[model samples]
Target chain A: MADGPEEIGRLIGLMARLPGMGPRSARRAVLHLVKKRSQVLLPLAEAMKAVGESVRPCVACGNLATSDLCPICANPKRATGTLCVVADVADLWAMERSQAFQGRYHVLGGLLSALDAIGPDELGIPKLVARVTEEELTEIILALPATIDGQTTAHYIADALPELNVTSLAQGVPIGGELDFLDDGTISAALRARARV
Target chain B: MADGPEEIGRLIGLMARLPGMGPRSARRAVLHLVKKRSQVLLPLAEAMKAVGESVRPCVACGNLATSDLCPICANPKRATGTLCVVADVADLWAMERSQAFQGRYHVLGGLLSALDAIGPDELGIPKLVARVTEEELTEIILALPATIDGQTTAHYIADALPELNVTSLAQGVPIGGELDFLDDGTISAALRARARV
Candidate 1:
């Protein structure tokens, strides 16, 4: 296909590399940006440049931050006795959205994966352990996924911090999830952990 | 929901406004960019900025260009005598990808839509007429969409240029299209334009 200009073509090529974007969609996106140059394209360019220049992983919690600590980690009012361990910065954002956890987070960066060669050191498990004692944290909440790797990581953390109350999120039917649509494993787990009203 | 940072949030908001992207996909794309800052994010930002600063509509045809004339318009080998009229720059790009046409293009910017208040002046029809005489064009091919507005625009252009040999793209079953999956309108059009061969 004949591309427009070298710059436009380069923009489209880089955009196509983004997750969920292909060549076709990237072309459409570039066209959209070009058409709305002053409003969308210029602002997006500025925002991306600003983020690239300033944004970094929070030193304390691994969440995205402009400074050393993330907003959650820097907030003194947040519960210091509790730390929620999550798999990634995205998970930390999800937890913040829920507003159920008032404590700071410990981003693992990734789960323990034998196939991918990711171990405890890679996930900052030792640093997490250090934080537990340094901050005098009483409880560690494992809000990891239900995947095998997530479970393994949770178990490893639990074993490492035997003194603290280490617990994982409950596996049950999701809110507004129908029994017919739910998988067998979820249904069984829900039945086993049925709550009494 | 809590956002990462002000810069990150602005980026996500602008990205979500792009074609085929929503809040969820935008968030995912932003996270992916943040993780690959040096490799993907910085380059993409630079490309967008460059395109935004330089790219503009060609003076001759309305196709995207960094200069007065687009690559096709500036090329001496391209058949200036045979002009193809399309509804948008995207359509011009699609025709280029086909490699079927070796003519210059005149982007209408949009079709004649009474509801949308679009007219001949808005589509630069007068400018097109001037180009015909100035450039000494012999044939004008209307490679427009087979929609109501497209047909109306085609008819208007044909009426305006009665002296020139004006034609439109053939409407039939698409190449490699299944008969069973074809819409009734397409089937009828294909039957009506059946070739002797």
Candidate 2:
């Protein structure tokens, strides 16, 4: 028999499914939650419930939102002419965190994976093309992962949008990245894109 | 402003407070949850809500449960004569996972710590003594941690129940632990507690 009851075990099982957590860490996390039930666990549960019940994809930009349009998409002051395309909502959020891009986002949900049978339609690429003309977006900035699939997806989108200026995030050395620790591809990319001091 | 909406940010903040997770991991986890709303996120939210609403301390053993008595406490077949005393419910659960102990458990909640002002009374040492007599326990096995406070707590418990057969877990090299990787203190302890082949 397992420790605690069936519900506790179920909670652990669900928790273990999270990105970084495994069985051992999930158990420890659950134990910690049980210890601080009122302070941490209850609040987390409430927050999750609130998010789960209310949060939805923004119809215009595909970003998470409670209403029809995400806060960024709904903001009239945001750069409407420039659309930032990302593989996932996480990447969109990353861009938002940087505050470098004042434009709205277009989440592809995932990259066009041939192995996974994910095509342009599955990733809503058609919708993206439609948005370029619909929103009169002048530029489409592809802020995608530095992976083969991500590059492939970016190329496909660039080809599809012949009228619009489709660009991608710069491929170079990250700020404060150690040269010794970086891979050969990154080092070469950094050398190729070297700028004047 | 934080990534996504207020509720999304709240969820991320709450998840960041978990044992192994930091802000970065929390953001990743929240993003994953948002993406897998129907499959992983909602189910986890429901499970957490269920546990938060129902789970409480086992009055008998301090183990978490949906009822007054924990499953272990309610189980009549578990070794009633031998009560394994541990520092907390997590320790009790760890012992249960080992499957070596076919006995009941007594959770101390925490160890005696002068620095933290945690005394015997705070640890429910008196309640533990009451259970020893009430349950007619034959042997009291102190399965505390290998810390100074753990040792002090064990000593206090041993001294309190003079008439009872007080014992403790042996200090030795852990199973599957290599001697070369072990600390000097552990090596010395193993040597001191050397067993015959």
Candidate 3:
């Protein structure tokens, strides 16, 4: 019954899958959502719907956008000669939220995981190289995770972009730490980075 | 640029307007959502779509459900001679997440507020009275908040149910403190109640 975990249990299960939310927090969150149907639940439902319909990956750079191209990729004023490469859109969003980095982004989708069999193709290194040339790119900034795979992906992309100026976000970004967790200020500091690899 | 907080800034603006979220937390949360688009955002978008299309209020209790009666109201066994009356769906969800209160719930939608012009009709007190008599209820537990309006609503309902049994959740449910914020254990402790009004 919906009265028991059997019925509403699905809610808890899905919530548990969320980051920072475990089985217990998931249960609590589901309860809270249902209880505040009008004031909280209904509005939340609407917000969810809007995001679902409108949210999509920016085709040009792999950043999130309501359109085919993310705002940065579409905006002509943004610095086209520079591209900040990141492992995921979350990292892209984190940098965006800082109100720094007037340049464009190229979301790598994921890192080069040898164990998972992910390599240059998986991380879109070839496309990145093409973009460096096509966009007349002067610099390519690596904002990848500080993991071994992340570092490998960065080197692979750097090696591919020999003609372009390449740099990495400072050692300031924690090892294996997702760029999402850093405060806006830290992201800005990392972007004013020096050359690497 | 995909590098500004414009959309996320707007999203954070809307999010900060939610019941509990503030500007700082909204900023952090938006960053999280944007970064985890594939893992969190895509799934969240799908979940929101499903919930939006499927979710509606139970005609009887105002609780969220994909069906007409809600799982709680439809069950014949749950039509047991007990009704747990709560001020809002959040309280109802709080009760549900505890895995307690097997009988059924009556979501009053809101407490009695004379100054705000809310009264018995506004809170569906008449339907509650009808449910008690029609279901041949043995007990009506007032799980309402203890705020002035919440207490006022409780007293009115209790008075209305003078001929039937009436009780209130015990000490664990604090005065004026919302049940949504209370953990499941506390809600369970209160529901394992002893006294009756």
Candidate 4:
């Protein structure tokens, strides 16, 4: 395809690199931006620039922040004596979206993956341990995925902080999930973790 | 949802307004950008700023360009005595991707719509007619969609320039399209425009 212009082509190329965006979708997005230059493109550019300049990783947790500590960590009311450990910022955001967790979060950046050469040091597990020891925390919630690597990381963190009450998110049928459509593993997990009426 | 930070929240909001993006996808994309700040966010921000500051609609056609005249209009070799008119810049880009058209393009910005109160003047149909007369163009190809509004706009343009040879993109079975899966309208069009072997 004929690259429209140097800058436009470059912009499309960069946009295509974004997660869930391909060349065709990137082209559509750029077209939308160009058409609504004053409304969408300018504001998005300004917002991105502001975030690029101001946003940083929270010093305590790995959550994104404009300051040394993220908003959750900075809020005084969030000190619930609990820290939710997640595999990444996405998971942390997911947890926040559900409005379930009341405490701060520690984003491991990723789970333990032997194939990817990711270890405890790479995921800031030592920092996590340090925080648990330094703070008056009583509970460490492992909100990681149910994948093998996620389980391994949870086990590792649990072993490292035996003193603190470490618990993981339960695996079972989702809130609106139907029993028939559920996979075998989910069904088994639900049966195993069945609660009393 | 708890707005993460002022800048981050603003970024997500702006991203959510883009084509093919919603609140959830915007949040996910923003999180991805924040996590890979150096790799994706920073560069994307810079590229967006560059495009926002430099990109503009070409004066002759509505195609995006860094200058008053677009690259196609500026190129002497592109003066193929034929002009292809499309509804938007995206259609022009799609035509370019096909690499079949060697002439110039005239983006109508949008089609004529009574419901939306859009007319010939709004779509710069007069400007298109003037360009055809002044630029020594022999043919005008209406490369609009096959929808009702698209056909109405095409008919309007054809009537406006009766002195010139006017045509539109053919409607039939798409390349690599299957007969069994084709819709009724498409099958009828293909049968009507059937070629002799």
Best by lDDT: 1
The docking quality of candidate 2, as DockQ, is: 0.74
Candidate 4 stretches with Cα past 4 Å from truth are: none
Q: For residues B89-112, could you state the per-residue lDDT of candidate 3 as single tens digits?
A: 667877877777888888888888
The 0-to-1 C-alpha lDDT of every candidate, in the order given, reads 0.94, 0.90, 0.73, 0.89
Candidate 3 docks with a DockQ of 0.16
Evaluated on chain B only, what is the TM-score of candidate 1?
0.96
Model 4, range A66-165, lDDT digits (tens) per residue?
Answer: 8898878888988669999999877887899899888989989998999999999999899999988799799999999998999999999999998889
- Residue A164, candidate 3: Cα error in Å is 4.5
Candidate 4, residues B1-197, lDDT tens digits: the string is: 36578888889899988888888888888988887778888888788778889988899998888899998988888856999999998899889989899999999999999999999999999999999889988999999999889999999999999999999888998999999999999999889999988
The TM-score ranking, best first, is 1, 2, 4, 3
Candidate 3 vs candidate 4: the lDDT winner is 4
- Candidate scoring better on lDDT of 2 and 4: 2
CAPRI rating of model 1: medium
Clashes (backbone N, CA, C under 3 Å), per candidate, total 0, 0, 6, 0
TM-score of chain B of each: 0.96, 0.95, 0.77, 0.96
TM-scores, each model vs. reference = 0.97, 0.96, 0.63, 0.95
Per-residue accuracy of model 1 over B25-67 as CA lDDT, tens digit each: 9999999999999999999999999999999999999999999
Q: Choose 1 or 2, whichever is better by TM-score.
A: 1
lDDT of 4 at B122: 96
